[model samples]
Target: MASSVTILFLLLSIISMGGALASSKPSGSSDPLIGEVCSTQSHLVCTNYDDVQATSIAADQVATAASMRDASIQTINDLQEDFFLESSLVEGRKIAIHNNLNDPAPSRPFVPSSAVSSLPELTTYNALDIMSYFGVARDSSMATAIVTAAYLCGGAALPGEAKSCAASTKALAAFVASELGNNVSIYATKGAPTTYSTSTSHVKAPVTILKVAKGSVEEGRKIVVCHHLAFPSALYYCHAVTGTKVIQATLKTEGRLRAAYIKAMAVCHLNTELWLSRHPAFKALNIARGDEACHFLVENDLVFTRALQTSG
Candidate 1:
């Protein structure tokens, strides 16, 4: 007979497999690339913008603009992959918890945030409007990502020489990740740490420690568990000490998971910003504080949280 943990993992795997299969199916109605690019109706404009940007890059005076455009496109694809992978793991965790606790599962299927429901007609977009779509703040990491993408995509002229968009985007992403106190190398390796370090070197403040009680050793432990489980390629177990209260223990575990989910999603948002900035269409527009974009990101995070809670 399979152990409970084995059964739990199997059930979770099936859910993940289903989502993957659904994503893999080819759509007959829409341009597949456009479908991949826009995850929601709100993001539809971004796809049109990307097309115009690509065309402009092809026609730019810089000799390397074409290559830069291709690189930018590839970066967007990479960001999409990162988003999907992170989302899958989070969804998988939700499934695992639900099954393990014998809770009712989510009624609806896991619809990806970026999944295209209908094909949108290509429309004209002003540079300002297109820039507004990204929802970037002038000094935010999103803004930096866009600038970096522009330089790489040959949308902006580099003073001395040109570099490949892929290389530039990668370097810029790493730099931004580091500046934001994220684990820069982790993005490339795409794996969770084997052992949780007591060191706070890479822990971003406010996100990791906010609302957590000071001098509460257990709270820190819970945060570490959440971080370990939520972001990485695999989940890690933290042993509960003997005789912990059942209700209290459950609440603690749930809190940790929630915190971890937020942190992981925030990272994905950061990555998305990097790719969003690089798209050719809005290269010339100035980035300002975008309340809508920021709200969308927060709303997406909340939706994920609610889905997990309701289903679990």
Candidate 2:
């Protein structure tokens, strides 16, 4: 019985060894099936379980690469769209400016006696003269004066018209106060209005006025001085100044007219500056186009962003 048991154990051991040899892969041997499955240069050994895992990993990598490529393309497309939109806005502003420059001057209504009466007597001063008197440079102060004059006169007074210098200076002071607040100093004459005060720090003006005889030739032919304190620049009697009349006439509501006039004057003043004229964005815009472009930009906030992008 013992000998029979020993023979059975030996037979079981030999069967187990044969099964292990059949399942194990030889170091130097390549399977025809594995070569066919792994046809690429990777030379990966393929088995039923390992082949599925390898294929899954490869597919995941391919999907990841494709997704990355697609995302990159989408990002590029978005950037291109943004660039085109900005470029179109810039072009539109340029065209608007050009058209405004070419348009004929608008007719202006006669200055009312009330407006004329409120004006104090002023010396005949051009843009440069006003800048000199104010002790400001030719760049921004001249523009501000022109805009201020237009606003105070309600767009009726011209540079050559008989207007009050004191009144215009007051208008300039008010303008500075409104826009810049306490950035400047203003000295008031005793018992006079704040507007009649002279500015000490930034704006300088003569205390004494050249008295003209009631019947003198200078009485009715008084010096016309209009300033835009916003621009701080001087302007001659031109369409930009006169165009404020168009705003007053076209708009039915007083509030709307005032708002439109302010916006238009701002553009006009900006156009007068040498830096703005040479600005890449405003290179195509000139003084002639100031009125229309200003209105257009004010109405379209998006376009205004493009116009003033480089202003800062």
lDDT per model, in order? 0.21, 0.21
lDDT of 2 by residue, 1-312 (tens): 322110001111101111111212234555332232122332221122211110111122322222222122121011111011111222112211211111111212212223433322232233333333334443343334433343333333333222322222223223333332322211100111122122221221212111111111111111112221222221122111221101100111121222111111111122222222322223333323232332221110100000001144
On residues 172-220, what C-alpha lDDT tens digit does candidate 1 reach at each position? Answer: 2222222222221110011112122322122212211111111112211
At residue 295, candidate 1 shows an lDDT of 9
TM-score for each of the candidates: 0.18, 0.15
Instruction: Count steric clashes of candidate 1.
Output: 2
Candidate 1, residue 205: how far the Cα is off, in Å: 35
Clashes of each: 2, 29
Q: What C-alpha RMSD separates each model from the true structure?
A: 20.4, 41.8
